[model samples]
Target: MIYQTAESINDGRAFLKIDEFIKNNSVYVKIENMNPGGSIKIKTAIALVDAAEKNLDLKNKKHVIESSSGNLGIALSIICAARKYNFTCIVDKNTLPHTIKVMKAYGAEVIIIETPHPERGYLGARLDYIKKRLVSDNSLVWTNQYESSANREAHARLTARELLNEFPVIDYLFIAAGTTGTLMGCVQTVTEATPATKIIAVDTKGSVIFGTPSAPRYIPGMGASVLPPLFDSKNLFDMVQVSEKETVQTCRLFARRYGFLVGGSTGTVLTAIRDYSPKIPAGSVVVMISPDGGERYIDTIYSDEWCLQKGLLQLQSSTSRNTFSGAVVE
Candidate 1:
């Protein structure tokens, strides 16, 4: 079974229950959005903050800077605010406005990067901006999530263990690939204990992660334009590349069928599972990690006007019934 965790100080609050819906396979969804910052990035955010607290001197005001699409920024903003640390989040145009508002509400100074870097894309642009900020002010501590060990360790120690405790038998585990922190942690844990469960890494069409050619991906919290340093090929069973169209359709379908409105990353996972359904035997238990909710996607993923403008379809056929085999990255 696949799993992920969140930001709240309390692990109880971070780990939510598994949700089951009527389908061929015994599928369970771990709702991590119920966490304090409404996403599993809270786990990484807290890990980074905890490490910084121990290593960095708190006597002087530390201005924490990081590049994020949305969730991590909000998580860091929440933790930093409570700890009395100044936070500056560098985001890109893909980040939802509602996400920015939440970060600001938690006292985070938000900076938006408009242009994408030719090689690394928006994440590269955000990192370049962070470098300039560091040059201008050495006092700024960059919580580099893309390259941070704490980001992966937190999930290995907490999220994976918690998930194993909850479900000992996980035939198939599906995880969204962004920073690859969560994927690494969960895959390692399950592979060690069970050594048999199939681990599926789901990525968006445009993400450069998994060595796929980089393209434009509007959704945040799912994939990265650059290959994350945290990513390793070890223990990876297969990698699934999902299109944004299917992701949007899956989110809409979930909302309509299960009445659960999930974010883009979660939608990507469900869509991957649907496409991969042909290979999955009936009664095989599958676990999916839902990183965040769809509250911030009101103006985009859930908006007809936005979909039409982007030439995205409003709805598509339900993915519950397998239509095609999911394409696996080489």
Candidate 2:
């Protein structure tokens, strides 16, 4: 077990079969949390940097900036730290505290946006800040995950290939969409290779990614108040929007049942799978991506006190193992 570089250590990640969880569906989860960045976003971080270098942008630019909820910020922080570039991550108030700490620990200047727009929400506020800052400071290069083709292309080239190679003939792929980079990347790959494989794009209830109304979305990894440029509705097989409550319940259920502390996005996908099991045919090879583990979410998604403060305590009493119906919470 020897490694050359810590920044680009994202290949052949472990994936496992959890077929017993859902009946009639051979459920499989790719454990992407094993990466050095502790999330599936490591691929995109590398790709974005590589693309920048290829275009000769990174040669003169020493400072890199991006607006991320949590995972991608940390990913870029790791890369920027390794490359000796000054990294500034503009995140909103909803991002997990541990996530902010991780980004900061990786030598990133973390900027927290405490306000949200009337309709656009914190995402819009973050974007506005980036735009204004970029206008003022010419040295800062905004990664623009929402609009960056590299964000989508990176997933298409790396993650999509990883998924297709692991499960060459999967019946369905469930992906939680934030910027829609991951989901669209798999969509592009599967559409070109296995057209029969359905792409189930999972979004949170408060997200506007799937025509859902925008609101205060606390969970970081999934859901977007603004529609991402990478999102394409043409090839989507279906859409499942899970609530914050359902996400908390499913995460707790996994922690209780399998002793695996999954993050909020993974919980949302699992909740979607549980609620959408009826749509999947019997014995279907259902594959999903677990973007990150639960360590970084220790404050919010994994804390009962935080949940109580956020008014999500109903999950412990209302949700059961058998019933995880996706109800609107925010």
Candidate 3:
């Protein structure tokens, strides 16, 4: 029941200035927003849901439950809506309003939970709840992105293939670590297509992916308080942890410099690139992945008041806070 849409590769590069960046730094940025759902999660959504239908009883299932804060949930909601499947998502309290609206608009039941839990965020708790519910009723399918091999397979098959076709001689691949599906898939692709390429896993300071202490993380994706079972550290060359402030600043810089409005996770990769680009040899091709678009954060990171309130972005000295629109040059 895969819904087909016109490919967006034909969309002009005006929104994504990959050409200029490539010309200046021989590095390529793969914009995954070109996908129909406006993120790379579409690959996983299609793969996981299709696999569920094949392996489990999804046709007459009452609901498909999963935990996600952003793009993955939206992707699932869209797919479920198209196929007439009942979709339910459990998300953290801090999720962006736009994401919730999108999920509800697609007719997916939305559940919000409190954040900063002993088991990390809502995902772990939601998984626990789903497990308990499954005990009572075995009809629902739990598409656990964190542990699903299908997630990794999706990236390995689609994203990796696309990257190999786009760049035959990639020297470095940078991706933000979340469920580790994207990173692992890209690693699998690089191993087969460009074995010599280095895979840099970027994480956030608060994410437990590297055993960091729990904190109030502003970024929607990239950092998890727990290491997902799918993450294979052996496949990575190095892991770099970027702070929330760094992620926010980088997102702002990216928007101003490239006019590319991507999510905070994308900022993590860009920050890694800015730090590691100089160390790489001349003319080596480094490809950074932008997982999703910026529309979801219009009321948060993309908002001037929100940035100032959170002390994420500051205006010029002597300029009244009221005049600060997050666009003031530093």
Model 1: how far is 125 from its true place, Å? 0.3
Judged by whole-model lDDT over C-alpha atoms, candidate 2 comes out at: 0.83
lDDT of 3 by residue, 206-255 (tens): 67887677666766867786669998888788888887666677676667
- Candidate 3, residue 267: CA error in Å? 1.5
| lDDT, residue 212, model 3 | 73
lDDT of 2 by residue, 1-330 (tens): 222233347775588777567877767898999987898888778777766666647758888988998899998998888788899999988888888888999899999999898879999999999999989998887777787788788778778888888888989899999988888888888899999998899998889999978877777888888889889989999998998877887887777667788999999999999889988889788989999999878778767778867876554345334433221232
Determine which window of 10 residues in candidate 3 has minimal summed lDDT.
6-15
Q: When superposed on Cα atoms, how far off is each prediction in RMSD?
A: 5.5, 3.5, 3.6
Better of 2 and 3 by lDDT: 2
Per-residue C-alpha lDDT of model 1 across residues 105-145, encoded as one tens digit per residue: 99999999999999889999999999998899878888788
After superposing candidate 1, which stretches have Cα over 4 Å from the reference? 1-23, 58-61, 314-330
Ranking by TM-score: 2, 1, 3
The 10-residue segment of model 1 with minimum total lDDT is 321-330
Between candidates 1 and 3, the TM-score winner: 1
